[model samples]
Target: MAIRRQDILAAAQRILSEYGLADLTMRRLAAELDVQPGALYWHVPNKQALLAELADDLLARVPEPSSRRRWDRQLTQLATDLRTTLLGQRDGAEVVSASRASSLDTSHLGKRIVEIVQAGGHTHAHASASRDALLHFVIGYTFDEQSHALMAEHGAAPARFGDSDAAYAAALSVVIAGVRAPTAGRAAPRPAG
Candidate 1:
């Protein structure tokens, strides 16, 4: 039977969940699929491309930004959903971060955030900045959580961080508060004398 792109992605996701990202190599994927390593290249040019596709597929579970709800509420929902989704998979945050850094993330989730921000009366630049800040916080925060869970699972040292869920909610609140802050009243920065 000929291998398809979806087949490769499904196998990759299984590897990621079962053994983590370090074990999700093309060679391992080919082994899982019972095909020659070169066969994977017919569907994906390289591991990075495959990872990007997988990341997008994983993020597809997140709910799209809703215009009907208040922007802040919608942002809260979106961020929470993203965190939940990332935590659902092994090394998921790492995969998504790599995809974003490589400019291979095609989920358009960031665009949705920006649109939500703009709908709240912010300028395009402000909305874009907010999107970046929000995503960085969500992704980085989730990454730490996943890493800690892995360490605990392997019988490593006890966690130094306490109550991650509460901490994350508080930090997310701070970020959303900043986004909701009025930009109009801020005094213009003065040039250094």
Candidate 2:
């Protein structure tokens, strides 16, 4: 049997699910696939590249934003879907965040969010700021949520908060409201003559 790129990805995902990100190292992955560590480079250039690919694969599970929906609704659904998708995999949020910081080509999730906000009649600068805020919020929220869940699962600590789903929705609504603020699209006023 030949070890293909998908095979590597599959093994990496399995490693992630079964052992979390720390155990998803290149050497461990190579061992999981029963190949020399160098063989992985034939398919992926390095650990950072492999992690970026995995992050992209995880996010790809999120459904595309609906055109029929209002832009705010689309933004909300997209953020929720991304959070759900990240929560579905172990250390998924961490992987995506790391990939985002390390590589410019990893995922277009932020870009899509910017487009959604722009469609809502905001300037590019406003839309971009909104996208940054929204992505940071979603990713940071999911990372903390997952970490808390993991800790509670291992008896390290009880879940820190109650009604997380509601909390997330409420916070997202606040962000969307900020995105829709009247001044969001307004340019600086010219000084009076």
Off by over 4 Å in 1: 104-107, 160-163, 182-193
Among these predictions, the greatest lDDT belongs to 2
lDDT of 1 by residue, 39-155 (tens): 888788788888789888988989776768899999998998999999988898999998879552224898888888888898988887788889999999999888988888788
Compute the lDDT of residue 21 as modeled in candidate 1: 88
Q: Which 10 residues in a row give candidate 1 its minimum summed lDDT?
A: 99-108
Each model's number of backbone clashes? 0, 0
Against the reference, the lDDT scores of all candidates come to 0.86, 0.87
**Per-candidate RMSD, Å:** 3.9, 3.1
Clashing pairs in 1: none
Where in model 2 is the C-alpha error above 4 Å?
A: 103-106, 182-193
lDDT of 2 by residue, 99-134 (tens): 888542225777788788888888989888888788
